[model samples]
Target chain A: MPQGKPAVVPTDGLTTRQRRNRPLVVLHTGDMKGKSTAAFGLALRGWNQGWSIGVFQFVKSAKWKVGEESAFRALGRLHEQTGEGGPVEWHKMGEGWSWTRKQGSEEDHAAAALEGWREISRRLADQRHGLYVLDEFTYPMHWGWVDVDEVVSTLRARAGNQHVVITGRYAPAALVEAADLVVEMTKVKHPMDDGQKGQRGIEW
Target chain B: MPQGKPAVVPTDGLTTRQRRNRPLVVLHTGDMKGKSTAAFGLALRGWNQGWSIGVFQFVKSAKWKVGEESAFRALGRLHEQTGEGGPVEWHKMGEGWSWTRKQGSEEDHAAAALEGWREISRRLADQRHGLYVLDEFTYPMHWGWVDVDEVVSTLRARAGNQHVVITGRYAPAALVEAADLVVEMTKVKHPMDDGQKGQRGIEW
Candidate 1:
């Protein structure tokens, strides 16, 4: 059954329609897996709504090809060809600050992450995408490559109705506080705890 | 960065390939949203790996149209036409046991849920799909419409490398104990807390 209206939401002034239309900032974090996967699922939903979707991979190596990238790209191509669904743009910091950057030193990775954030900030300012997924974005912030305060402020000041989702472990407290929705994926059990390894498809 | 090898996996006894190939019973449970969405994301990954994906929606109303359903169905059609990706079959219990049962009484719903589980059990016996997503399945077992003991035993006895993922809130304790991976999605904050409602695409 759907949960009842939360007590935190005041029923005094705002109309139901107004409440339904509010843009959201979602954060998915914790020690468990599926944080990025859930964010991608939201992106898939956004794409189906004909909403422009942007995916930014902060920590995954460019060489590591995740399935959502392939699937979303296919959907994006379908959109371009028949005007179906929505456009999708995926960027990886591992590829460098720009898609053309293939390899770099440790300092370069940090620099690239900052540059990636700069681009995301610009996109937020322009409201370029209806849904933005910062997959594993918490790491860069945790590593001090991106300023959490600036991120919180930029997200707070973001224009339009664009929805943003950040996924990774140990999300900064400030970001969590600023987010309209926060889901902590707690690990109750893991195969790794049983000496099992992640396989293809299941892990990627 | 990818996590190092799991210490639980004995280094001497099992080869890395053997360790990576173990099938998993994954459970996504708790109050927060995105449980089924994460399973669909895994199906996307499995599809990309050329694995047949079966999605069984156990509780969502048949009238509800989730984006992952559209996206995966499209991908399924693509596979049929061009032999790319993998085949996909999506079944909804809300539409009746076989996706054609529209409206029904309360007892009818229970019976339909049982019938759905029967089919799933058969598929598990046959090892029909590489990835089997029992979306919102916990509710049926929780309601006593489906036998949790039977479900657990059948899953344990199932053949092949098929992976099963069950998603919903209030997952039974037995199932949790049986699962190789269990993630409890805790809600830290929500827009609904501020009187915001679920929107199309994002909610479905």
Candidate 2:
């Protein structure tokens, strides 16, 4: 016998109702050029769908040149382009959020980034209204500044309706294998390897 | 113009020479399921390519079920299935990790997970191998026990020369956006949603 209009049918480890858990999408990549642009583009689409999107630049410290921050931050501002309400908020280092000196031992940098991540996650969890993005997060891990298991576990525990995006290279195998989707950007060509250093606005 | 092999065209931010740097693959998901299986598969493939492979599972604590622990410890027993290695080395979590059950705040959990990520990242960095996998990382983050941003940054920093994967569910958006690959698994139909809960050997 079935109850009156059950929200979701129970199957395996998922419920009909729970199946509606807005899917957790994991995109693992190391390439920045088109990957970052593509991520921002997808984020914009998600925002249009009424998802609250959070943009988190994990490894690119706030101290980076203003040009770099602006370029990345502009991605978040796309919400405005959609004519959505509210503006993209930022949590830069030394501004409410804990700060990490750009120069430090691998351990120190990792510790500071971890602290930054904690703050970002807290804000994302509390917001609960849209999508959250953690940018350049894989940097510290690649450099041995953070723990892969702990980060993976914490991410798994997010409750309520929310979507998160983490960018950067060297994503731990644990994260990639567990992801529902994986888009690898194999470098086909670029101007950097030729000594064409990153330029403001264009390459930052 | 176009000197020295056409300026060493950069693909996805790396030159052909740098392409030697294995692309980092992150497998982030919830629970065991296909996480370990995928890692074993990748390692076997890389091993065939004559590339040294390293597998590291970030066990949050030593309280793993006896059967589960034994099974993981015996992963290398199937080297024949992989066809290229005498035995894959396994590094189980030691005293360098712990979970503070009493600390339930999101911040506390993130902090603990950050510590764990740092510890694991340290080991990964030392290896400098071609492929590495961080399993069950999302467990801590999902439980609010890890710093997601820190984990992402760490992964991004050491991406070059080493391909990595992170596995878990509820993957932070920052991770998905940062990754060169993004995979989303939708439980279109599961037994749990149909009333059949997890079964032994299958779900465990």
Candidate 3:
């Protein structure tokens, strides 16, 4: 409800237009749910603006399907058929790279995760999409499968106005410091605390 | 990243189906952006499952239009025309209730907020929607316009499986306690801190 000019005004001496045009690095991390949901929401906004959307799912099993993936894929098709919104590319590391790897092997998971990051890094370098959603990406970093320093540096040096959003719990301090916007989803209460399970439409 | 049977398994002896069937009261309260956006994302999920979607905005000005509103409305229309998704009803208290009230008067704003809440309460009683999004509703209670205790009691006693999501900053402690799910968006960093104003597609 507090409004007006924000307390942090641009001390960087950039013109208003320059400041407004800069791409952002957003981090959504914490124990609570909705981090990936919020990131997907942002992607929806970007899609409406004709921004190409790239969604990379890191840890979610291939057997699991979320509502956003279907919705975005449909929107992607809509864009293709009638040029309505924006294009969407959805990739799951579990299905894409880990299928060939041993299912429960830690080393195989780590390798697949690194491969996923490599692909994302390549996309960033090539400016492949307008919005990149690294869904549940913090796990690889937390598990030491991917290098946080490399991720930070690559994002910092990313060119153009392509926005990147990383969502997961236990985001590293280094990544938090590197992000332009960071939101921690603190858990005040959860139904699971009262022994309630997640519902189909609600949880996914 | 932590997964398995959630730590809080139902000690109440409720079946898994029974636990999943209970409706949720969710609160997204914080200073950071994306509270309402996340709620809209949930609405999108609900819509895909053929759930009626109700979005009520309490504090945002009528002139300010966010992308989710337009997107959800279009999806609603698509559902009607093609039998896809679900119905949507969006109402903004700023335009709907406060149009005749003095713009800057605190008392008038408070009164308008209460009237809006009354309408939502009525809808809840009727089980009018599958998902009710009370966007920025916390401001009224924070400003002492609406009674927080009354809101809590009404929600607790309400029947039916309709889910409710309330989003705003400064949510009352009592409301937090009553909610089945609560997520506090803690701000670690924001571009406004660097003096950048909200841009066209990204902000609205």
Docking class of 2: incorrect
lDDT of each: 0.83, 0.48, 0.81
Q: Which tens-of-lDDT digit does each residue in A4-120 have in candidate 3?
A: 475766578789888887889989998887787788878877888888999999984643336677667767777887787788999887665433354444457788889889988
TM-score of each: 0.93, 0.41, 0.89
lDDT of 3: 0.81
- Sorted on lDDT, best first, the list reads 1, 3, 2
Q: For candidate 1, what's the RMSD? A: 2.4
**Proportion of native contacts found in each model?**
0.68, 0.05, 0.59
Q: Candidate 3: where are CA atoms >4 Å away?
A: A1-4, A62-65, A97-107, B1-4, B8-13, B62-65, B97-107
Among these predictions, the greatest lDDT belongs to 1
Better candidate number, 1 or 3, judged by lDDT: 1
* lDDT tens per residue, model 1, A1-204: 236465565765878776676778899998888787888887878888899999998974654447888888878887898777789998877655554445554456677888889999999999999999998899999999899999999999998989999999879999999999999889899878767777888887
Cα deviation of A60 in candidate 1 (Å)? 3.8
Docking outcome class, model 1? medium
Q: Please give the RMSD to the true structure for each candidate, in Å.
A: 2.4, 21.8, 3.6
- Looking at model 1, the pairs that clash are A195-B9
Q: What are the interface RMSDs of all the models?
A: 2.0, 18.0, 2.1
